[model samples]
Target: MPLYQLNETFWFPPVTESLEDGLLAIGGDLQIPRLLNAYKNGIFPWYEGNTPLWWCPDPRFILFPDELKISKSMRSVFRKNIFDFSINNAFESVIQYCKITKRNGQDGTWITDSMQQAYIQLYREGWAHSAEAWQNEQLVGGLYGVKMGNVFFGESMFSLMSNTSKFAFISLVQQLKEEGIVLIDCQVYTEHLESLGARFISRNAFIELLSTNI
Candidate 1:
């Protein structure tokens, strides 16, 4: 139950204490080995400012590829060819954009300088990837995350235009479907993601899936 410093790799008991809460060890460098191990163990880094906090939340939000909702409006948006999607095309740019973009109720950003550098490193090593949405050669929106085996751990996403991020996500999901991916780890709940068909699963269930899949 003790919260440790950011330099530690393992976490304490997850805040919720659920098996999925994954409050294991914490305070470690976000080096490739450490990050890979963390994801393999169902742990992920999520901290504000300079602290490199890691987490495993109970009742994690996830979206199975087949469960993705393609509402009529979204379908119409897709048909418009408003954006082009690519993978691992602009990983660092996507992360940097997500860090700088403003979110409702948030002035500063949780994606600190160190975190950006860390994820950039991950991308170089092929452990991380980005789904990019391009508008006439301009990067409008995208997302970045880690992929281990068949599971993708979503880190963050951003959009500069309406439905851009959604297009990137839908494209990523379709690609994952082609690659036989089964699960996407959303980490926490948000109505936006929920609206896209992401649903909650107990941390225990999440860990079990990670153990078996990743």
Candidate 2:
């Protein structure tokens, strides 16, 4: 199935249309308008290179603000004020680090140059945001994502020091709670995120929640 097809004009069908057909389509432009529309419709881009690819998996991963877990050691770190946290305060640096940092089980990053530039533009337009962890006035770790209404779609995160990224996540959730945000979309499943209280739900359910909550 073509992931996307130009029907008369450029408007795309609901991403849910592709579930019956696996890995639906490929190749597209990542313009801001298209990205915003895709996100609003519960779709997201996740390609390996210059060619933009959109996806809507059958089972979506997400984390609710109230469900976040604070481990004993993590709590201790916060209690001792190990790092300072801020929001939208150094987004470019955070994304750059995420792009360059090596993953434990992965060889390369999916955050391509085009993706980086797109999100950076989104940040400047206030559609994207970042949470930073600073130690001794130096950025140790952080995460970035797009926030639409009350739904925060987490793109990626990286840690330079133990627990720094976690601290940034906790702070982001805290702020989201204050702002009346309802959902934090993790996009995919990972044990690390599960430990932080992220859970899975049918993609259908996720779309419904976004429809009602966002």
Candidate 3:
């Protein structure tokens, strides 16, 4: 199938037309309206190098707030209160950290300069949020994602210290649960996320969830 090329209008190709690898369209500007529309439809941008590629995977990875798992070891860490958690306090720093932090087997970063600037704009518009983990009065780890109503579409996370990202994630989940937000879209599969109670649902089901939640 031919990859769809986006025009100036805030629109996306049908998610069912995505490549087997989940790449659906390319060349769309990451404007606020486009980004929000993408997430609301279970589509998101992800690319390395220059081009902006959009995706909607067949088996969506997500974690319902009530399904978050905390291991005994992490429970112990939580008890220590060794980390401080903050929300939307350092959006720029969190994205910068995620941009630089190396991922296993991946060269360069998907979060390019334009992407960072766009998300910063999203934060300013109250559509993006960050969860920061601080230790010794310095930022250690955190995550950032776009929010549409109750649905949070997680983009990336980074940890300067072991288990710091996990701590921040757990904290975010608890707070979101309290706020009556249940669905968190992880977007893709990862062993790390699976261990934290993220599981796969059919793309059809995922789209249905987004329709109802956002």
Candidate 4:
């Protein structure tokens, strides 16, 4: 199948049209409405270099709030009060750090200046949110993502202090779950997230979850 190139129409092709590796389209601007629409349909934008690639993979990575795994050590960290947590309190700092935080085997961040600004706009509009960890009122770690209805589309996370990002995430997940959030879209897999009980589900099943949950 040929790849679709997005135009100013501000819509995405059906997720079934995605390529084998989940590349559905390219060239869409990251406007808030487009981003929200993409997320509502289980599609999301990730850039490779400068081109924005939208995807909805066959095996979507996700976490059920009730299935969250907080190991003895993670619990111990909480018991010890290792970090303080808040939501949406340090949105720009969290994302800015996620942009600059170096990861092994990665050169440069995918969160370009434009992408950051785009999400910031979403933040202002109340669709994007951040979960932050603080130490002595200094931002240590956190994550940012798009939240709609009962779904959260996680974008990126970073940690400056030990296990602080995980701390922030676990806290946020528990809070959202208490308030009726059922699904968390991890988007792709990572061992770090796997430890916290994120797993894969079929794209079709994921879409159904979105249909009912959102």
- Tell me how candidate 2 scores on lDDT: 0.86
Q: Which portions of model 2 show Cα errors greater than 4 Å?
A: 5-10, 19-22
Model 4 pairs in collision: none
Quote each prediction's TM-score: 0.91, 0.93, 0.98, 0.98
Q: Output the better candidate (1/4) by lDDT.
A: 4
Q: Predict model 1's lDDT versus the native.
A: 0.83
Give a tens-digit lDDT track for model 2, residues 1-214.
Answer: 5456433233667776775522434666678888888888778887755666667787889999999998999999999998999998899999999999999999999999989999999999999999999999999999999999889999999999998888999989989989999999998888878989999888888889889876
Better of 1 and 3 by lDDT: 3
Tell me the tens digit of each residue's lDDT in model 4 across 1-214: 9899999978889999999999999997998889988999999988898989999998999999999999999999999997899999989998999999999889889999899999999999999999999999999999999899999889999999889989999999999998899999999999999999999999999999999988
Question: Which TM-score value belongs to model 4?
Answer: 0.98
Better of 1 and 2 by lDDT: 2
Best candidate according to lDDT: 4
What is candidate 3's local distance difference test score? 0.92
Error of 4 at 127 (Å): 0.2
lDDT per model, in order? Answer: 0.83, 0.86, 0.92, 0.93
Query: Residue 85, candidate 3: how far off, in angstroms?
Result: 0.8
What local lDDT does model 3 show for residue 147? 85
Flag clash pairs in model 2: 3-24, 3-25
